[model samples]
Target chain A: MKHLTTKDLMTAGIFSALYFLAIGLVTFICMFTLPVLGNFLLPAVAALTTGSIYFLLLKQVPKFGAITIFSLVMGTFLLLSGHFPLAIIANLGFSGLADWFTYRTTFQTKHKSLLGYILFSYGLTGPLLPLWFMKQQYIDNLTSRGKTATYISGMFQYVTPTFFILLMFFILIGAILGGIYGQKLVAKHFGQTSSKQISDLYD
Target chain B: MINIQIKCLLLFITHIFLFIPFHPVQQTVLVGLLLSILFLEKERKRSLLYGSIYLVLLGILIALPYFKSFLGHSFGQLAMVFLLLYPCFLAGSLLIRTSLLSDWILLLKKCRLPMYLILPITVMFRFIPHFKEDFKHTFRLQKMRVPHSSLFKRLERTLIVLLHAAIQSSQELTMAALAKGINQLETRPVSKLTSLTFLDYLVATSSLGLIVWRSFL
Candidate 1:
């Protein structure tokens, strides 16, 4: 339990894939189905759906570096799949912070883990940051890809400061809701409500 | 068939190419070139599917104004991004569909990543297909039990079962890998027994050539 065992890494990988699929499904559906609300709904929906998977991973591994490894794989996948490279940086920052936060509680308390999930959920905003922060590059990219000026303008129509603030708010609400649901799911299904239960099963 | 390294190289090049401000015609050519490579590799079905999707999206973009009143411009914007990302999507599909765990392990080992990182990544890739199947099975089972349930309820139950199955299988998979001495200190480095074929060489050269050409454009 001190270091990441091969088994721990393997479990992390398996769950990372699951987590990615959950997030990917939500994002893809939102992006295509509700073009207008897609950007705003994506992070919130992703955070909402992925909480159970994330909680399960924590319950299984419950060690340092588990969250880090999970997020690293996700960030790398996003980058390879054409997300802005800053996605990786944001992922590392948030996941590291989440890992540290969980470690501070020694993975014992539920409150700290919920806080960690809230922080980790902010990482979802990384991919969309380029829309606001690097507006020119984003425009140039669309224009280069042969988008019409109308299309580009339409894309930016929702990228206002208000929307950005709203996006963060959605992320926070989603994280809180998802974290509570996730805790309930873990406590019900795994029967391990406390760190002592997790340690006894794994360590 | 192309090796994992070549597939990864193409994927990497495609990612970079996505951001490059190439002329519209040149960008289309690059996508066609990559599709041709997929065709060469005998993935004609997927290549054609991707090719048709690209054309359909392009058609939609061209006819943007007609749909604008109802669908709004966001539809066109999404179509544009998808159109541009078509080739990248194709390259990624090829990589994911074709690669094996041994190939990834060999490649990651060549890059000298630690065992922990390598093991997880490999397992992730390996588990994806299995998880998909498990998800389908669980969804069907949940639907049978609660035939009148709401979609959200069915999905939630399915996911719960899916996660439980995944955690259970992870324990089994770890034991299987460990029994095979995956974590042994004295294990030999994975050797490449298959040499690069002529097609592999041609694909590599043409992919690199496309990247270089796109960069200058």
Candidate 2:
């Protein structure tokens, strides 16, 4: 595989920053809105937020390792941000999967990029792993601490295995929608920018 | 002087410690460390910002027992929300805020990283400031376009110009780095990691001990 240049790598960094910023925004909004909507809708919103950055990055530089690098950086930061290893590892793994999609095949067009983005979206479920794997342990931890039975059972709406499965499905739908939205923005805005840059270079 | 390799290792190990299962005591230790680091940095403005965050998180964690009655099921959830990020919040922020890209590359070299990985990271680091400059130009040109009261139109134009400018700069940046023969170097200069300091030893020992404790103890 051809190596990435300084600019290509920098672009990835910038996009990585931008992508995580979107994630922060999505997470914040979800947290505030949690009172209105249950925690169930979070995976979907989180998935959609990833779309803009993936689309823009793919459109600008569809290089082989871009997605992988972005994913690694993002996962690293997420772990640093106090996320669990299970989810962070899952994010990297899914991102690796997304990288395979682009690297194994050409990623020059919207459709190819969208496919990669969709695969990458599966990683958004990383945040949900705590609920998935720790449901029993978490409940036990709370219960042993003297939390009431009613309180522990009340969490069923969100922490149940069924809800977790549905959350993944919702995440998939949100990611697909995000991909479409990002592609549309690219077609509208970025298509105009490509030619403009050539003119700027000449001047 | 402390070694970049150690710094990188410490940073990574610290992050892993944040992930230890059944780790409340360690998390509390990390939170204390984070607060100390922030205060040591002494950026007055950021002090309030990060300080408030830690305080709020501390409050939530402390209030867990008291709030459990009212917050009910959500109390556990909310307490968890705070608990999860308690350890790494300061560490991640400090690492990103404190280190430069060159520092990371130097550490990578010290670790004997491949040129393929090194080349991109160096460039990615260079990209942020360069893009920031490019965006400023786009914003300026956008302002010129909105000579009158056409604020909305100007905003749209500015955004378009910004995207064009971003794409253009990225291409230019690639060409420049490539032309500099970033990838052609056969070997990187060997890095000498000097002695670890007291603070470094403390971090290393504590993190190592914590890992062992979390894993097997």
The best candidate in terms of DockQ = 1
- Name the lDDT value of residue B87 in candidate 1: 66
Give the range where candidate 1 chain B is weakest over 10 consecutive residues by summed lDDT.
B65-74
Least accurate 10 contiguous residues by lDDT in model 2 chain A: A76-85
Residues A75-123, candidate 2, lDDT per residue (tens digit)? 6556544455567788778888888887687667556677888888877
DockQ of each: 0.49, 0.33
User: Which ranges in model 1 have alpha carbons more than 4 Å from their true place?
Assistant: A28-36, A80-86, A105-108, A142-155, A193-203, B65-71
lDDT of 1 by residue, B132-177 (tens): 7887788888889889999889888888877877776777777787
Query: Would you give me the overall lDDT of model 1?
Result: 0.77
Which candidate's TM-score is highest? 1
If you score just chain A, what TM-score does every candidate get? 0.83, 0.83
State the lDDT of candidate 2 residue by residue for B79-192, as single tens digits. Answer: 565456455555655655566565666655666756655655555455556555655676677777666737546534654554555566556656765676655544535344
